[model samples]
Target: MGVFLETSRLVLRPFGAGDVDLLVALDGDPAVMRFINGGRPTSREAVEARVLPRLLRDYPWGTRGYWAAEEKGGGGFLGWFEFRPVEAENPAVVELGYRLNRSAWGRGYATEGSRALIHKGFTDLGVERVTANTMAVNTGSRRVMEKSGLTLVRHFTGDWPERIEGSEHGEVEYALTRSRWERTRQPPAAPRP
Candidate 1:
């Protein structure tokens, strides 16, 4: 119905109004925001007054505020992931993204959640494509994108304030079209016959 998608180990649920604290904590981690903000922390007020509201306001649309990536085993929050239709003229295209705490890193949580979202985008949401973009230097994120079956689509530059070391190299976009996704999906093997 609303913003809830489930994977084997996660429940991607909507970010309630109360999740401001979570945002504060998440953005406070420098290593977590390293590639984006150059390891600076976003103020809690900024998260509450701006970011959280923007995410929460999008609930009615095909996209939700933010999906709280909760572990089904412990029912604990790992972070958040978002899969949403790009609001441009090309509305059928969705963007895939996640922001997780450092503690959640190296656990394949990003890959697992991304695969589920991609499958749903094609099979259930009638999405024509899924796209993700990040700094070219963010190899960790690039790996997740690649593992989700997206390929490098382009390299481009964007304006940034902090200007990390590799900003000059530009950013990369990885994308998967519906046809590509369908073609790449392998049929179930005959139970290892």
Candidate 2:
């Protein structure tokens, strides 16, 4: 399998046909699905029919897409990370997202992977902006975004298809522009002649 990115403790790679079971199990966990689908488990049929196909075709314009995150030491599947365009109409701006197993929570895997991808986006991919959104009550994800250098850009309600527990609190969006990201890592190589 081709690796997309790497961190100190994790390796991010593209999903393969063999990853269907893994994806199903990850989305099946209630705790994992709590914030995402109100604790509803994704069915195997759905994973095979819709989800996997969608993820496979997701990356067209950007170098980054949905990647499976595995631990480097034991080579276990931790979760997946997405670094892709926020909208099909806009390729300059990318979105950062992650979904980890409940066992992998609180261990900084999310933040570490996110930080690495953000760095690559700014320094390698020429991405203009990176954005992320989460439920307002998802403090864990918000903390990860903050640690990854994304600042709160907006807070507004969304028209979600399903009613979730924390939907009432609305959602928050975090973003970092290439200019802001570069400033944080200033004093780089000389400008292109």
Candidate 3:
């Protein structure tokens, strides 16, 4: 029952065995999965057998893995966030990602939570860089990344196994280095006296 982190409006905690249904419902939303799995809902078997196991196993990453985001006051499930290594990439360089319910869309939860995680990663955690990727057509997600102080680093095509509707447009990567993030947090120069 490790609590990873929390923002003003959200609490990010670890997912447990009992959270399978939540993941299932979140993944089942077509609007939520529009870009992720091409609007294909995730099966219960996959959630129970594969997804839960993977999430449970990821707990060992300490504070750097997947987290279940919930409302602090109402305890409502918003979605999940991941701040971890980019699979074999530099350990100091973590990746920031999130999947929130379509109902939570349009609100500033995504940007708020992401900025908090980025601050934690650069300050409390040993992260030197943070990266995020999304379909080029996912302007909402791209805007969140930008609001979190990340800049467009690259745009490239992935060898995706499935050809989704917007896959032809390619993917985009956004990144923010610790130095850059720190600069954003620094207070402006004192009045030149």
* Every model's TM-score: 0.89, 0.91, 0.91
Clashing pairs in 1: 55-65
- For residue 5, model 2's alpha carbon misses the true position, in angstroms, by 0.8
lDDT of 3 by residue, 1-193 (tens): 6668766678898888789889999999999999987999999999998877766654224543788999888778999988887764455788899999998887788887888888887777778899999999999999989888899999999998999989999999999999888778632112223
- Top model by TM-score, which number? 2
Off by over 4 Å in 1: 1-3, 59-65, 88-90, 186-193
Question: Whole-model lDDT, candidate 2?
Answer: 0.85
lDDT of 3: 0.83
lDDT of 1 by residue, 41-123 (tens): 98988998898876765532455635888887667778888787776434478889999899889888898888888887788
Q: Least accurate stretch of 10 residues (summed lDDT) in model 2?
A: 184-193
Summing lDDT over every window of 10 consecutive residues in candidate 1, give the lowest-scoring window. Answer: 184-193
Can you write out model 2's per-residue Cα lDDT over 1-193, one digit (the tens) per residue? 4777777788888888899999999999999999898999999999999978766765555444788899986689998998888776566799899999999998888888888888887877768999999999999999989888899999999998999999999999999999988788522122123
